[model samples]
Target: VKVFGEFEFWFALIKVVAIVAMIALGSSVIFFGFTNDWNPIGFSNLWQHGGFFPNGIGGMLLSLQMVLFAYVGIEMIGLSAGEAENPRKTIPMAIDSLAWRILIFYMGAILVILAIFPWNEVGQQGSPFVVMFERIGLREAAGIINFVVITAALSSCNAGIFSGGRLLYALSVNGYAPSPFAKLSKYGVPNRAVMATVAVCMTGVVLNYFVPDKAFQYVMAAVTFVGLMVWIAILLTQIQFRRSLTQSQVAELAYRTPWWPYSSWFALAFITLVVVLMGFHEDARIALVLGPCLLGVYLAMFYIVGLHRKTKLSREFK
Candidate 1:
């Protein structure tokens, strides 16, 4: 896991550098249009074929479902808080950095792509990253971009395994999972939990082999739903946590979420919007239904086995 972290970090740096380069190059092309002989690469792509809102607000709304997948690993920065030596200092710094990271890496990259190519024609030309670089006459840019993308995918997989293992380890320690899953190897890795997590993930590979085309859509939607569900839980948990604290206790805290109550409320509203939008897309609706079905099973098991007592004990110990 430690080595995985190092690899993920390096690959992420590669992506950031590549994206920063793209944005810089794309900006030059847009404003100066020197590549186009000072033609002033304009918003014709945005509004020419159809207006910016060509598909209407509903189209924008539905796009959120896909967009959520892009943010799959955003929560990773804070996931290690329980084991961190200085979470109060590091966690806030991590969260604070996300604003700019999202701005430059995600939003900025999309802006460059949409501006450089017609909105509808962007995907048709191939990866905007490679296309933009190719325009600058780098034939190797496509292979490099493809390599970076492969690394990014690997990084995501590494993070997913680490997250799943840690979660099950947490549950095991709390007595919700088998006690053996909580046991760590000499290096302090939860071997049992990691193996179990990897096993579940491998099931997806097996499904893909058998189902091919249908497998990806179903799994992606399920993953998106889980991501949304986790975010909602985190927001609600934070709100409750803040509510539980006295004003003096809250003030004594080293870190606090800005805008207090409103921030939490707004997050809840935004997540609610995503859920509603999920229903608007047929493929996503599978997740909307299946998420609750899975939740119902979990709830039923929790009550049937009385995991709440163990959970309370876990919290008290923490």
Candidate 2:
């Protein structure tokens, strides 16, 4: 945690600074003609081209598959609570700030980019931020954007390694994974689990090298499908946990999701809708097939490894 925590801090800071800078720069260009010629860029670019929603409602719904993919590892925030010194205080604060972060980092950035440049002109080949900066005659700023993008990728890898090792360790301790994965290093690190995760990541890299064209699409779809299932499982678990608690016990909770059943049901329905939409997409449709097959494989592993017997024994003990 210590090694990666430092890198995560710097990477997150750079991303935040970059987003804020872009927003401010875009605002200046829109409101005060801060570009090269000192001529107001105006907001006509936002609507004059395709008048927004050019792809229609179905297109927007289909895009949610990728949008959900962007949030794939966000649940790690909750998972990390188990290791926190003060989880009750830190977890709730992190959860509450999530919406604001999404609004500012994702929505704000997209809004500014679209407002500054015509939607159609934003190419698919490179980062829109780089394009925006270069268009404004700041080539050096574009180079910096590229560097930031690299750091972002590195940050993602760092997070993946951290979360993957912890999850593997949890599984090992629960008797689902191999006992070797439960072992820790002198520094209290799950070295075996971490090595396993790195091995899996390398397999992915080799697979990508073999089929570079289709690799990302396939991986994104699979990851998004798994992420959605994880979220559903979490909500259901929370609901069951709440049902097991008395009203007074619930009242004493450190954090509670607002609207209870209503919000939970709404989120479930929305995620289901996204999954259904994935079937309509060519690349994402594979996930609908792969997901069930993967689940079946896990079920087989559970029984094959005698986990069902262990579960029965635990229940008898309880």
Candidate 3:
């Protein structure tokens, strides 16, 4: 795995730079009198307009799908175990810091945005960030934010390609996908996997040119369903991985998930609730159907491709 190679390293750097720039710009606007109505817009907004649960428990519950999606990349650090300089030491250190880092970056940023603008009023005209800057009468700040969001999208796309490529490579290795996907180039990169991922992503570019509105919505729904399925798989895999371990080996886990069976169960339940919520909203309903359908297709393919037979024969021989 060319984990820290030129492409991955540059893409990560771009994301870091964009985030730091947003933070710095936001702080300057808050601290200095960089705008006309220079008010702190303190924490009080969290409760002032219809309180914290303004949208009621239903809205909050529905929002979990987006929140969980935001945290999708959290496991990327763990996936780097294969290429880490020192797996045991570095992996533990990263895991130890992961929770706090996410809380500060994801949760903290949301809090700040809510403070600056009323939660309900957000997304009324456009992005809450853009609205806040415009409220402060900083036209330039708004433009800068637009640019930042563009960079953020590019960074996200770059990461998505990288992740999808790796996933295809893994599937190939397990014989769940074609053998060509497992082939690598002289640079130690899964070139075929990279090309395949890029090709799939380019379909979006073509759709944007042809059927922009409908295509974009369909693509977004598909992506969300795919993401939800991946999360469910990960949680299920972790459960099986833990169950298969001996008691001594289980005790040796460096970064065990908290609340054990309970937390895992709760996470699964929360995901199910999100799916149920999606069914209530017309915009998200397609995802509710698509997610399970995709999973069913995967199961059918597994059986049709003789994965079970191969595994059983291998086990018998062993």
Candidate 4:
């Protein structure tokens, strides 16, 4: 896991560098026409295709799920907080700077891509970044872009492994999962929990191997639903935590979420909107139904198996 963590760090750095390079190269193409025989490309493509809102406000609103999906990495900050050496300082800084980073990296890259190529035709062949680099007479760079993309994918997998192991370990400690998951190796690693997480993830790989086509879509739909639920839970937990604090305690806190309760409420509303919008998309609609049903089953099991009783017993003993 430690070795994987190192690789993950470098993979993330590569992704950041690749995005910055793409944005820089794309900007040159947009303004200076670095690759288009010195003829500037400009931002005409954004409006020329369908005047900014090709499919209208509804279309834009419907895309919130995909946008939210891209922001899933933000949740990793909270997941990693338990292991953070100075969470009070680091977590707050990470949370505060996330918006600016997203604007500069995600929004900036999208702006560059749209400016350099027509939106509709951008992903028709492959990545817009790949096409842009190829157009810039850097075929070698385009090939490297593919390698960078693969690393980015692997980085996501690395995150899944890290987060899943930690989460299972936490659950086990809380008496919600098998006790074996709470065990730690000599290196303080949850080897059992990590192996279990990998086994669960491997099922998906096997499914992909067999189905080849529908597996990814199905997995994504489930992931989106699970991600939405996780975000909603986090916001709810934060609201409850704030409510549990007295005014003096709140005032003494080193970190606070800006706008307090209102921002959290808005987040809940936005998540609710995304959940509703999911029903409109055929591919994602199953999640809307299945997600709640699964949650219901889990809730039922909590009582049926007397896990709640175990929790109360543990608290009393403590």
Q: Of 1 and 3, which scores higher on lDDT? A: 1
Clashes of 4: 0
Off by over 4 Å in 1: 34-38, 314-318
**Residue 133, model 2: Cα distance from true site in angstroms:** 0.7
What lDDT would each prediction earn against the true structure?
Answer: 0.82, 0.87, 0.72, 0.85
Please rank every candidate by TM-score, starting with the best.
2, 4, 1, 3
Report backbone clashes per prediction: 0, 0, 0, 0
Question: Which candidate tops lDDT?
Answer: 2
Write model 3 residue lDDT over 1-318, tens digit each, in one string: 445356656755665664555555566555553453565445676789798787788888776666666666656675677677888899988888878877766666666677666787888898776776777767786787787677667767777777788878877876778889888788867889988999999988897989787776666656666766667778899989988999899889877888898898788777667667767666567777877887899899989988766552212110
Q: Cα deviation of 109 in candidate 2 (Å)?
A: 0.5
Off by over 4 Å in 2: 309-318
The TM-scores of all predictions, comma-separated, are 0.92, 0.94, 0.84, 0.94
The TM-score measured for candidate 2 stands at 0.94
**lDDT of candidate 4 at residue 260, scale 0 to 100:** 80
Q: Judged by lDDT against the true structure, how good is candidate 4?
A: 0.85
Order of models, best lDDT first: 2, 4, 1, 3
lDDT of 4 by residue, 1-318 (tens): 567668888998999999999998889888998978989999999899788879999989778777777767568888766667898899998888988998989999999988877888888888888988997899999999999989988998889889898888878877888889989999888899999999988878887999888787667777888899999999999999999999999998878888988999999998988989998977788888889999999999988877877634244111
